[model samples]
Target: MEQYKKDFIDFMVSSNALKFGSFTLKSGRQSPFFMNAGSYITGSQLEQLGIYYAHAIHDNFGDDYDVLFGPAYKGIPLSVATSIAYSKLFNKEIKYSADRKEEKDHGADKGSLLGYSIKDGDRVVIIEDVTTSGKSIEETYPKIKAQETTPGGIKIVGEIVSLNRMEKSADSDKSALDSITEKYGFPARAIVSMKDVIEYLYKPDGSGLITNDIKKQMDDYYAQWGAIM
Candidate 1:
């Protein structure tokens, strides 16, 4: 793994965003662990989170993307923070755009989009926390593509999430990220994987250590719900 990715795993644990325990997912499967990006609410945590995202974005998607599009709610802050980091890290300008649950009828920028306008020919990359079932993309992509400012429409170059659970979606055999890429014609990348999480916690390192029992639990969980891709 890259240094930033390793550091991000530690950051997730320290922020309590990634937890190892029995949990039930919205898909109705029992998960051995869960990652909630909402735990990163502090100043330093968000700063580091943005840095990790920026690095991963640069690595996977390069610096050519014109905008960062985050979904509503959690993705709003993620888009803003990563855009700031991208500007600072690469010294290149990047716009941040996010979706709104409903169009604002009384606001100045009264549209479904909350930030930078999606102009035609704009290349966008999505920043998300985690993608297990790809529900967000299914809900938001059409709305985003429909609002393109030009005839050619905006192009979504790729998407990056904090973690790839490496589990199949509810309706597919491939992993959620893979399914999204296959269906949408763009690549999906993550800062780390559940495999990385398990390896980091199982072995000795500076972040933290996991017990042997927990290691087994993680393995067992993967056996039940994991996807190879």
Candidate 2:
């Protein structure tokens, strides 16, 4: 794992954003652990999160993409923070855009409200928090494709970098990044896996905030859901 990945997992475990317990996901399944990306609230924490994302982007997608398109809601801040980090760390000033749940009367009048106009044939990358059933990415990709001036014109890409990419049988385990990479050859990466995070927390000298019983409970809960990757 990368240094940032290790550091990020440790940070999240310490921050309590990566908690182990019975939690319900959008897929209507019980999860042993939960990664609440929205819990990263502080300015410094957001900056660090952006730094990690920028690292993942450079390592996976490199300089291939021209613009970063983050979907509505959770993706808004992710796009902004990541663009900022890319500009500062990599000296790459990539433009960022995002869609609104409801279309605005002004602006593009099409729905997107974050960045400026994305020209035809522009190489765009989609930014997201996590990949559950891939429903969100699937929905956003077509909307982006529709905005192109020419039919089958723009270079549409999906760059999904998340904290966890669970096994298919686990709760909300759909791997959008993996599927897209296999389908259209877009780059996919993650800071860390839930397994790695869990193992890290259990090591004798590892960074952990909870007790052994909590770890055991987490392990048992995860077992009920089956193997996780």
Candidate 3:
């Protein structure tokens, strides 16, 4: 595994963003582990989180893209943070854009989008905390596609998420990220995967964040809900 992947795992553990135990996911699956990006509340934590995301984005999608389109709510911060980090770390000025749950009725910027105005010929990369069943992308993808005035449309270069749970979707045997790539015709990637997390944290001597029992539970959970990948 790469150094950033290991450090990100440690960051997640230290920040309590990634937790092990019984938890019910939005996809209605009983998961042994869960990750909540919202746990990074402090300025320093958010800054570090942005650096990690910026690194992942640069590695996976490169800095050639124009816009970072984050979904409403949680993703709004992610987009802004990563855009700032991208500028600082890579010296690239990437625009940040996010959707609104409700459109503004009266304003100069009276539309569903916030931040950068997505226009024709812009290339967008969607950022998110995690993808479970891919319901969020389903809701936001159409809104993004509608922004294009020309026939070719604005290009969605790719998607970046903090973690890949490596679980199957509600209706498909493929993982949520994989489903998104197939559906949207663009690649979807994560900073680190569950496999990397297990490899780094699971110790047979029972001296790791993931103990023997917890590893067993994870194995069982994967057997039932793991993606075909």
Candidate 4:
């Protein structure tokens, strides 16, 4: 695993955002862990989070994407901080845009709020903390496609990039990204897998935060809920 990813995981653990315990997810599955990006509230914490996200983007997606699209709420800061980091580190100066739940009808532009206006056919990379069933990303997809500012001949494209990808759903037809890429031929990537975190925590150099009992519990949880991908 990359040191940056390990550090980001450690940051999540330290912030109490990433917890190892009995928890139920949005998909109604019992999980051994959870990650709450909302716990990062302070400016400094958010700045650090952005740095890690920038690193993850740089490491995984590199210059492949023209713009970063963050969904509403949690994605707002993620988009801002990440763009800042990308500008400072890679000198790429990436553009970012996010959505408002409701369209603002009376602005000077009277449309979506984009940090950088998304042009039609622009290749955009979507960022998020995690994925359960991918409903949120799917919901945001059409809105971007609907942007009036996008030129008629130009196409609006979206790809997903995230901190983690949950295990493939046992009852589902495809993994979250697979469903998108299968349809649109866009790509998806992640910084690290939950299995990587678990393995990291078990090593001698581990923070000793995850005990043998916790590992057993996690394995058992996976047996029922499926292993972390």
Tens-place lDDT digits, model 4, residues 1-229: 7898788778888888888888887777777788888898899898888888888777766676777888887888888888888888888878888987887788675567657777765667787777656577667777667764644533434454444544554345456655555655666666666766886777544457788778888778766655233
Candidate 1: give the clashing pairs. Answer: none
**Model 3 bad stretches (over 4 Å):** none
lDDT per residue as tens, model 2, 1-229? 6778889887776676777778888877777677788888889888888888888888877878888888877887888889899999988888988877776777444555556557697888888877755556668877787788887677865475567545453223445455555555665557677667666667554346545767776666555543333
lDDT of 3 by residue, 76-129 (tens): 999999999999999999999999999888889888899988988999999999
Query: Best candidate, TM-score-wise?
Result: 3
lDDT of 2: 0.71
Superposed Cα RMSD, model 3: 0.9
Arrange candidates by lDDT, descending: 3, 1, 4, 2
User: After best superposition, candidate 1 residue 194: deviation in angstroms?
Assistant: 0.9
Top lDDT hit:
3
Task: Show model 4 residue runs off by greater than 4 Å.
Answer: 148-162, 170-174, 204-207, 227-229
Model 4 residue 72 CA deviation (Å) reads 0.5
lDDT values, one for every candidate = 0.87, 0.71, 0.93, 0.72
